[model samples]
Target chain A: MNDPNFQNDDLLDIHNLKTYFFTREGVVRAVDGVDFKVKVGEIFGLVGESGCGKSVTSLSILRLVNPPGRVVDGSILFQGRNLLELTDAEMRQVRGNRISMIFQQPLPSLDPIRPIGDQIVEALLVHKKMDQRQAWKHAVDLLNLVGIPDASRRSHSYPFELSGGMAQRAMIAIALSCEPELLIADEPTTALDVTIQAQILELLCDLRSRLGMAIILITHDLGVVAEMADWVSVMYAGRVVEEASVNSLFEEPLHPYTRGLIESIPVLDQDRKRLNAIPGVVCDCINMPAGCKFAPRCKVQIEKNMTICNKHEPHLLEVSPNHKVRCWLYEEFSH
Target chain B: MRHTQCNDGQSNLKESTNHILVEIHNLVKYFPVRSGLFQKITAYVKAVDGVSFNIKDGETLGLVGESGCGKTTVGRSILRLTRATSGEILYDGKDILKAKSSDLKSFRRNMQIIFQDPYSSLDPRLQIGESVGLPLYVHGMKNAKQRQEIVVAMLEKVGLKAQHLNHYPYEFSGGQLQRIGIARALTLNPKFIVCDEPVSALDVSIQAQILNLLSDLQEEFGLTYLFIAHNLSVVKHFSDRVAVMYLGKIIELADRDEIYKNHLHPYTQALMSAIPHPNPHRNRQKRIILTGDVPSPLNPPAGCHFHTRCPVVMDVCNQGEPEFKEMSPGHWVACWKVS
Candidate 1:
């Protein structure tokens, strides 16, 4: 699967990664047979609706899937080293030092009782052996870098005292305190209003250029993915149904699910009488169907006599140089 | 169904060029903030402060604003779900605010509301059928068998099966639950409905489904909607006219095309540019990112509430609030700069 010319450029690569929750009711395959790669300094968008396993895939990378949920199979290669094979101590060192994550809601992720400044300082102190005074100064600088006004004064305030945008800025400050190589932001601006959301998105793009860090942005909003991501992966059920550059994906989506998703969004400029919404809900994970997960909702499959779609699971095969899709419609095009 | 009689009475109501279903004039709703052990009234939150607009018959009026901007408060206040502090709410030429309890009870049948959070809005204890049919039973639909038949028909109208009637709320998905919510709102054959962020909580695909269903139902029933949402795109698609709200105030109100094409208010412009375009090829617009959070309604800025963050703030803007006046045929803006 490795191309010799572009091998080292890939920062994080996953091969058939599977994360499942073993509950008494049934084994829920959250992230099943997922595969994708993020290049250095590129923004890779992981998008899908709720319960589609986009979040689970990110948690699996950090080895942060809690008990009852486990990474059952597949390898997560980060910087050519398999993360799934790492020891707990090594993984801990890799967490804030190399790859940091920001959550959807920043308030609950932060400590309510502690000052926001102290939280950043604590992250710095734990990861690096630095003096308290120097660490505190660096924390203030980080806060200011994230565009927080009156950083020094605002730092002393508790998480509850800060607004939604301010709290998210604090979260970003903590994530960037270590100057990590990769930042995994899970719906970073979903809680924010549009104005603040744009501000946050701009700040992230600025930080990426200044710090030269790769980003894995996970969101359900396709508009956000289109604006920010260099490459996009459309997830369904628990697997990546399609992967392509942002331009190509939006211009001409190959996978049925990706096409439906893009068509489903209500565009701001266009006065579309009716949005072409995909019928039916996502597949049930515990009792998932045999073949293509999206077959039930695929209008293409229903139109053409694509009986193979239901009988056999399709692999993510390349149709173009950079575009890959997991659908039988492109089977003949795959080279 | 027995409720069909109510529609006959509504149809007799005069329909003319100046036919307005509901008109809100200088509505004010304030919740007092208590303090200390004595629980004295410290100040009022002023959730809905002096806002006025009219919903034309069989037209969808979009009420849009950022969170905590009193959009939801306006919808609730118009329904009298939360008693207004002051101002007149005229429903078909009758002041609902001045209506007696008996009158208000009957008027509620004509006006209904669909809440944002489908999960919390519904009662988990009751069956889905009972939940949808509760309004019918309360508003004098006696005969259990007749109510059940109407409930089944209503559920079918919202794209649910009759078998779903016996199921509990927990048994349905978020999209399905929203459909049930819409079913409940439509069961009364309401002439006007306040869809308060109805599609905000659902997924994108499901949101489109719900929006389509709403449009279809609107055409079928000749319903007037006050569609309240934070997402501008959805509102633009569904509403004939849109009103932009700031902290407890309507900063701009215009026809859908006028608001989108000739947005005059700075706040509205900022909001328009902030929407992330789904197409990547389009050159990104110069976004006006408003700095600072919305001020607390308790001690709101003295003059214009938006002056604190407006890019083109003037001395007069800080000293006095601008009057919301019609600049064009249908466009109304509350900004000194626009004039």
Candidate 2:
């Protein structure tokens, strides 16, 4: 998304965003010093394993962080407006109007008590100035747009009554009811079968092109990111360890964590036995490493015995054009 | 520095004689959907409707299908965990479906299941030790000290320590719990195991670790598996032979390479193409995207079950069921359009 043509079209600019949870035990730095930019109509991939704060970053952007968890520092700039400075009412105007999220589990996120069409109409009525009949008609149209067959008939069904794929489509319909400028899809297809996942991914890409909405796709599956994202930001332990264009990231990943994460997956195209798994478990965030958060499980750091990786944390620096890495190994290239 | 699949997860290594370990013939399991008063049977769910496959000795047979496609039921029926409506499940040349209770216990010891849901599969109230050790106690491993020693040894085999014996299910991560489940399944040294989506619930990093561990254990123990899952890549990377199921029927079955390189069935092609390749260059538009949902199993479309969504459907496909013919040696497909 850093292409010269889109250089001035940064839709969402997040600078040093730090979200922390002050639990009873201690202050958990769930999202510490994260920085990225999502340009207009560009897909920004935020990838990590579970508990890596990918979801938390999305929550922070929506200002959904509740008590005991707060955005402690930094600013989130959306379309020349600093969202952090806005009051709750002002932020509400943006939430679900300008931006919306599609959760992992559609059944739980969707209102089970009411018909899915009503849910979409509710969002429409709130954002779009339309009567109930018009909203209901628009809701059915949204459902049809999301590829739910026989939308008019299916719209009357409750969340639980619909199949997993249909429920996901309904959720997408609701998310699209407002025609959001930015859609944060957090593992939108994780619970779906491969065929259904393909359908949903196709729908997302089609919607992006048609509506020209920027998407922040948060997922653990590299395959999905490879197919969908234009730029990728690989997260490790609440920090963006690497960010690069899709081709550059895959071709020459600089960060050890990013390489390990990519290598660990069993690729469909490749016929290789025994993956290069990142040894040791994900580091405990409460007692995070003093240096690189990924140092303990990092093969390169351990192999080279880079003392700095254990003693001092490294900051993300541009190593190649449009490619940023946070590792001492690439410190020379950064300078 | 991990050579083990525990990094994510393998295929091939079916080198022992092609002796069939377990054989299933016309396996049919139908759950009667009842309604109204007196619990009158309205219609059958047709869960594992007329499905069949053979697992060769020490060879992995991957059973791949979407949810509610009768893959789990097929696994359950073979193990006798759930009784089949009508089928012939032969274990080591003897039909176990006809086995008496006394003899059935022996068959149960020979075959076990590693469930999909790591959390719900194991009893929450029981310590992992007790949960893993329960099978040993059931099979008459009476001495408590001996059971503990065996449990400890098995736990260590799966990369866990003896100290984790007393920890409950809640204390362990998903990968560790799967490991524990594997250890328990292997305690009796079962010749065959049904891995029901064992790695589906875990994270990507942990999934690799568990997969590698499963492969390593299979080689070491010479265990045959009916690996059931919907993840095509995982299945292809695992089983020596892959069987693709659709609407309670095996649409295709072939060697690992044959299935990927030379699949004939339209359904299989759609399925293989649908798997989001890790590489992006293969555009999504190139896939054979099948329209419409999988028809309900309760009343599967007559003729070819996949005809409703087949890209190259024929008039004959809607007339009668296509024979599961041998298109090539060892490669099976059930589609008239394959010709």
Candidate 3:
């Protein structure tokens, strides 16, 4: 079951991770019981639509959950050690050294007043314990590695001086400066143009191959998951509804939600009047349902037979050798 | 007025004439830069410099470019949301750019616009019903009850409920707010719409719902649209014809299939090459990584605006500006090397 390429040489093993935001109305369960393992040289995709708790999950891994939100349950094991159990001091040591994350929006993520090169150097010196002279050189090298031309001169330029694409490239350089074992990229290409998006993805892919780093790519883009992910976890309302290999998930999506998402993508070849969009909006997390999270918007399921789906919550059941689904359809067939 | 694109002079032309609904002739919108205590106009940001295209009666024309490419300006200028410096905006053979207040108001009823961010577009204080019915109130169409009914109907059309009409912008999701925005634009029964990155702010799953709704609404209403966005995948699906703009000018405009299949312009080619296909197995060509940023609109290149980034840049590109000419029957491109 374990191929060298998709090895379980656990770099990051998240177990029953839950992040909930405490609001006056109710507790918004952002990421509930998401369990996944990232190997040393594999790409794991945490994909879902907006408000599906993908970004929250990434933030949780870094121990950066804000005031309203807290990690209510579960363990984040990095290199066989539990990160949740670690003190703030130890967690800081692990943050940029063991795990680094690149934000979706590069403009705001960067220091506006400071030069981008200085940002990279600061991250390097603070995390890697490098000297000022050595860190500056490393920062310029990192910028060059990210395909930024005139790296030395451009490094001196402020964040505002660089274009949108350049700012993104600079952010990538900063994220990869420490050469962390695990890199968490949250919608890295979301704000970029198509060409620039492709370039950034290619660069990430190239870096992954070169460094042999484990990556947890969080995005709403199914196409990106298809291209880069070895294993896919489709999140819906703070829970992984379906988890499978990229091929299996694409070829035969067991979860109705997964199928709807795939069908909704507008193909260049198809000359259709309208796309097969999944009707209804995503369920509000503040007032989440008791049963299956997707039960309210589910179109194909028979309401009468959806008693279990509406009343009782379903756990991830192994339907195939590797494929697992949280839907009631798999439960009846598996039994 | 109905079919002006099909010129009678061309003997090779087989398709019927009068398919064009909106024809722009040398459309230029330059924003003056005021400086100093005297407020002297030093320079101008040529936002939409000599940009032109034709939108068919019922087909959505996708206008795509980077952030500063003047795509949204073209849309605003068409609807007369922003006054153009100079150029002709022909709508049904009448110059709408020079239209009087009454005539412009009539033109506004025929053409509407949907903004990018629904939250900012909609007033948080006003309820959805009031926002949607504001156009009707402005036009003096019906009484409050009648306006409410129309708002409800429009809300239903965008896949929303009448019960939610009393809710404000903050009460709804990004997708829901966008639907409200669409409802607001359509309340006046406009024949044409400028959807300025309508679904860019929504989630991927919600994006599908909005796109599907737009397609359905377009079919039902027989509405023409100018879909402006940076997302190439959405553009490919939504538009019948696509135009690639750069530095305030269109470099390439062609039929959907033709552009995707056999792209001619360097910028269009680079843009198309950049879109990552769903299937990773298919080996894509090396991306034409354009060096340097988009040139400032205030000081564009002397000749070809794209010359700085063009992979196959020539001496002629730096010498003089290339003439925008029709390369094929339905395909038009502006490049020194094309002719």
Candidate 4:
């Protein structure tokens, strides 16, 4: 079936994507009807707190959702092809060859027993059909591209021997060894120190410009999103509550949840006695509340007495140019 | 060259208020790195290498650095959780490092700590009430009823309800678990607390709540905090003064505003620039991206530990360790080029 929300220019288009975890307790709607699009060469940021389904959505795109956790509905269209329709064998061709992913913790993602060089060579060998010697040389080049000093010497070292920053760089090298069209970096810098994080971010931006690859940068950090993302989608309770250009999202955050999240982060310049914290805890994914999932924790809902927010679910609607919000307040502004 | 002269102004100011609650002088903590079956100590990982700082009464002193930079070690060493190799930790004039077992017990009553990860820190088997009241119980609060009352009150202070007391650690979320951790830390009514990356593991919104809660508690109880975190922005927000550590040593120390406004040390400047500002438009300044990871503490680079990565490195920086001298009234820096 053709997805109504599909766009021809989109490198990755996700429409009504619902990924749920089937547990004995109940179905946990992890990525509950989420929608977003990533244009070619654009850095699309999927930002949210832990358990908000940002990672699940990324996994869904790659069709990496393991059993018990499956994408129940939605079309993940990539370059006119539906990723969900592709069989496991068919999907293998698309995995590392066309799309690649880097995880938060680099050490565990890499094989500790194998030399870093062999791992990158293995990725090249599996996907690129390169000989062992050619793959080894390509691995060294990839390592050098990621700014790993003395690439040849360092490639011989195991994952355990490398520092956090070096390991992350090596992970990036492996992710980019095939020169994939899209790179999904899941909290790539979250595990590193501030200085190292800066270095890694610079490297990613540099790699993007040089490699001309579209990226889906998934992180919990708003700051990282602002620095790197061209467009951003803020996820809450497994849905895109707000989607806009990076500047618009930061300046005029439409959703109350989005506003709270932006205000919650303590910036280096601002000095306030207390941060504007969103009241109440995140709603349970297993037995989610009806209507707006954020209504229970929303200050606007409480103050405005928006009873409809608790009764009817709000649809993501475009309120302005390139800005969309899934909120009852903007229900009137919907097209 | 000794930079003792730099502290003259600080010493005079110290006498006027005499509010220096915790004064760490020449503090050093080294962990032995062993190898082979014999387990002979080959080298020492200089965790807290001759670090010195003063935490005033009723003020939050932020200690920030990358992981493995020994920020946690400093906090742990000060609390005597892990004994310091050598140092003078003066808590209101009495040296805590030299305190006897009896004295240390009393010291424990006055000092408390909140760990980073709420998941592993609290025991899953224990009920929330028992964990919160554990400090009180250990401190000779023999009455279970009184302990329960204190735990309930503390939980309320941290924005948790009385109903939460009966729940296990597994039942609560990360934010709620953090609140329980804070409640436990405050249960003893300690004068000083070490909050080690309390909000780092939490979400942004939850971090705000916990930070506000910490500030409110500080106001109510007049608690002094050594807030240790790697997040520079959070440190700037929550701390009265901040210390930037690199390679097991505090490279810079100054008032929060002073440090943020005019950082003398190159390492400090790089760290400030490294923080990805939430507002993209505001971050037009060219970020000073430092190269390479922090050198291993076991065999740190000779001279200034940061010399290898410093954008403005000099020959002298690689030759000898720079003295941590006060550049301004309250701003202290350890760099040869700063002067």
Candidate 5:
């Protein structure tokens, strides 16, 4: 089943991807020219605030964007093939079988009436050549793999019957049924409590190592990203503002937005009373600024008298090894 | 009211009073869950069961817990926003629940609440100025010109411009809207404020701004706060003392340092450990991953509420409920193993 020609370790390569929402007010540039690579068995974090297009970028990869929103430009190269070029049927074949996704709210996403086992078995039946009996048995095994105690009995319970944590575990079981190469977990732990969130993150980490599957963990919490992701691409107003290893991202954030976000989080370990918050809010996608989306709110840009920041949007410029920042302040560092 | 963020020594120097401003004794709130053909009240969701704590004047007391843990219920009960099932809520030596209707109106003027979702809390139809000045109108402020002036001044205190008075809730960002919420709370110049997850709805960039504003307001006005939030770090950062709640009960109550560093309760330990550390290297260590979901509060475990999922559960934990006791100086815990 392995394709030798599937290129380098980049399991998913998104290049200049643009997904826009055609609303009555204006064109909402949700995921504007987003570029990133998810390597084999790598945990790639997409970090951003709400409406910054982290979810849209993920949705675009799976071709899940509705008519109101469309993946207008660029390509999603998954397994050496441009996913955008694939037919609907071909894409469907690749979807659950190769790349499965688990959402934030597990109970709502799962069918209310059907037993979780039937739901999971349905996924297996649709993706694989398995009878109901075999699929049900396999579903229980998958549930067990996802750390659900009394898998067989629990599998027969409906979504409402299970608690939030257990429902999340059930969702993970369904996601892992086909054993996809890339698992897109979009805020999988956001709806959960702290303890439950930790469990889910641990499961994600454990499953990644055991199955050697690349993961795209989309989350707003930098702490969650820091704890789990090996590398991260910080998105601001529908653009990847910076890319760096998890350590560097936390230690020395190059982008002003990234720096502000990191500093903004309430300090856990230190005795710091005051937090250094960024001024202003997230840029609007519809009535976007002429230049850098963050320029108006960019303190460093104004401090440095970088008027160019307001005139032209800065492209992703590689400064350090394996680190890239999209800002006018770091222009001198770029080649 | 139009004072700038007094970050220069004055804000840091908290002139906190030692005497309790709010004394909640054995507070309990249970929501009725109806069922069957006749829709009879078959059970009760014990949202806040046997919770007790105190908030000192001009001091921020953080109440933290997971979802449905009754932290919010506790906050609401103190202000008499939601009627408690039992227990006494003493505000400045006067019981709030026993206060007459006419007296409670004045009591509400001294006590205000700022909700979580800044978007929904403020009316979208009303102008920002009207929303801010609404409380003044209700409290028998007659002059429109005077109300306008007060609203403008209050808005300025919260880092909003005089121009923003004309704009609606939709026009402002979540942070600015939250500022409006804070400004509204301060209009009556309340002595106490219940900040219910004020920054949870805002982005990380904006959360700090709101927190800074809240702290500044607290300092400038000498306002007491009962800060209720699900995020432990936010609570730790903002509060002087903290109370950790679990399944409608205050399992642990201590100073911020003690709660963060030397947490006594097993549930508290797990909750603390569950927080994803900002540093990648640190979170890889032993995180006390508790198994199973939080049991329904409608029919909590016969013994300890947390015994169902407690990692180090003993026979006593399952047999009888442990009494909440002060094990250390100002540190209270409700676990049999801790003592």
Candidate 6:
């Protein structure tokens, strides 16, 4: 991904991306000046809990931010080309051709009445400019690629006929119909059972390797991130709290938020008496405080072990060769 | 936190009668599928078939399975939320299935349910105060003013602000809403509550909050729970004993620690393996991918329902139904190979 022909070091470089939602009350800064880069053929996991602006960032990348929710700042650069500068038509070509996105729910995304075959073919016909017959054939091939059995017969089946796992496979097939360069999967397995969820994640990894496609997987599950992500970006209250390679992030997470998230996860090996949860809920995104978003619930800060967290929002500074953390503890430790 | 130590071990060798609070015997609930204008009974979809377990008083019994595995059905049947076609549900030495209407009302006071979706489970139009106190209103406990006071007390009990009582269900976050839901179930001072995927709807950060709240509330209230969820991790945390349901039957039921440490049932093993371990250092074996989907319960496969996908399936697994038997002291399994 960081190869010489990487075309300015990133497949997707989002600089100071800001997505705000205008409600009757006030503007909710769903995503506020977040920056990260995804390289070619690499899986960049955007990790965050609910209401942390991870989904908004992905939606902004595709210019799918609807009314009331608007990208108010910064640029989204892919392969040295700015997406914001492109026309709607150009962006249309970009979507499903160069970059495709698979949403969390498959049923709502798919037209219930229409057969899945036609819908998948639409992705091909619209993006690839393929003939009807060719698109249909390609659609079936894509379905097979995602491991949907009896692709030929299953193509004609409606979304309702397919199970949740199968419908998810159809969505994946549609996403990969045009063989996009990059895929943005938003909580692809959140609703699925562990068995089916594992299968889906495995399929994503397999697809990435086979197609040499870069992926930006947005999820809260640290296990999914660790398993698939080459690089991981931990988001908390509309900010990139930490960014590191998957190995580095897991081995030595610098940010307290990242550490908390990791520790909160029920580890299989340890016989934990109680979950070490970061006490207190996530801050309401609408009325964020001036200081670090995680300051209120931080144990170290409460103990006065990390005083800087309360006064200033630390920038994501490099703590290691490939790891970056935005935390006062890291700053003090490094100093 | 309410701390009542009750062992809900499956009935087996050295069976302790004291631990058994609710015993289900050969429970079967089948929905008749009809076709044509005449509505002829074509087949029966067995949602819960030959499922049995005993829940100890003041103990959390975790029932885990994939969607449509009859786990929810098991919970609903126990509470008589859904009428079971045939089964003996022995609750504290009384058969509730044969109880009268007025007796059922008394049974309802002891048993309650906390649904999965907090948004839908709580009425949108009602205030948190009225919603939590609705049972009191139905039972005619006190006037509106007194009911409001009790609701506020319950709200504070679940870690919600008393002021938030005036707010609608839409006002609170998912976790807080679940807390309200919990508060609603607890307002009646129930002995047992069926928690069906209570924390699954919440975010990971908030899940712990609700789980901790449930644990604390259980200890405080001396409550028993038939905790059903897809998340094995949370189940491990809250449950004293765990039951793994598949298709329409309980494949395995054992102590939480024993199940996690040494799972006997093939289905349980597969489910455990499938759980993505957050720790990257502990590289578990690639999940045992169960080949094929769960067979339609309308006409479940012959013999062992899991034989279609079981990796180590035997000849007998396809010929006859595997007997649900006690494999160890408290561990109960229904597999032919687990001698």
TM-score of each: 0.97, 0.95, 0.93, 0.96, 0.96, 0.94
Q: Which consecutive 10 residues in model 3 chain A have the weakest lDDT in total?
A: A1-10
- Better-scoring candidate (lDDT), 3 or 5: 5
At residue A183, give the lDDT of candidate 5. Answer: 94
lDDT of 3 by residue, A1-335 (tens): 12245344888889999999998888999999998878788899888988889999999999999979999999988887888998999899888877899889999999999999899998888887899999999999999999999999999999988877889899989889988888999999888877677778888889999989988999888888877888889999999999988878888899989998888887665666677777778887888888899988887666455677788888898899879999988787666
- What would the per-residue lDDT of candidate 3 be over residues B106-129, giving only the tens digit for each residue? 888888999999889999999989
Give the Cα RMSD of candidate 2.
Answer: 4.2
Higher-scoring candidate on lDDT, 2 or 4 = 4
lDDT for model 1 comes to 0.92
Candidate 1 docking: what grade? medium
DockQ each:
0.77, 0.60, 0.55, 0.81, 0.80, 0.60
What is the TM-score of chain A, computed separately for every candidate?
Answer: 0.97, 0.97, 0.95, 0.97, 0.98, 0.96
Best by lDDT: 1
The local distance difference test score of each candidate is: 0.92, 0.88, 0.86, 0.90, 0.90, 0.86
**Model 2 bad stretches (over 4 Å):** A1-7, B1-16
**Preferred candidate (DockQ higher): 1 or 2:** 1
Model 5, runs deviating above 4 Å: A1-4, B1-16, B37-39
Cα lDDT tens digits, model 1, A1-335, are 23244458889989999999999989999999999988899999999999999999999999999989999999988888889998899899899889999999999999999999999999899998889999999999999999999999998999999989999999999999999889999999998998899889999999999999999999999999988999999999998999999999999999989999889888879989999999999888899889998999999999997999899999899999879999999988765
Whose DockQ is greatest here? 4
Q: Write the per-residue lDDT of candidate 2 for residues A299-330, one digit (tens) a residue.
A: 88878888999999998999878899988898
RMSD of each: 2.2, 4.2, 4.9, 5.3, 2.6, 3.7
Which tens-of-lDDT digit does each residue in B128-242 have in candidate 6? 8889999988776778887877788788988988889789988888888999999999877777899999988878777877887888877666678999998888788788899
Per-candidate iRMSD: 1.0, 1.3, 2.1, 1.0, 1.0, 1.7
Residue range B1-339, candidate 5, lDDT tens digits:
333343333334345457688898999899999999999999999999998888887789999999989988888888888888999999889999999989999999989999999999999999999999999999999899989998998999999899999999989888889999999999988888999999887888889999999988876777889999999999999999999999999999999999889998999899888999888878778889998888888889988899999999998988899999999889999999986
lDDT of 4 by residue, B104-202 (tens): 999988899999999999999999999999988888989999888888888888988899888999999999999999899888777789999999999
Q: Which residue pairs collide, candidate 5?
A: none
Candidate 5 similarity to native, TM-score: 0.96
* Better model by TM-score: candidate 2 vs candidate 3: 2
Model 5 chain A lDDT-worst window of ten? A1-10
lDDT of 2 by residue, B1-339 (tens): 122332132233345547798999999999999999899999999888787788898889999988889999998889888889998999999998899989998998989999998988899999999999999899988999888888898899899999999999998888889999999998877778999999999888888888899988888767889999999888998888999999899989999989989988888888888887666666545776777778899999999998888889889999999999988899999989775
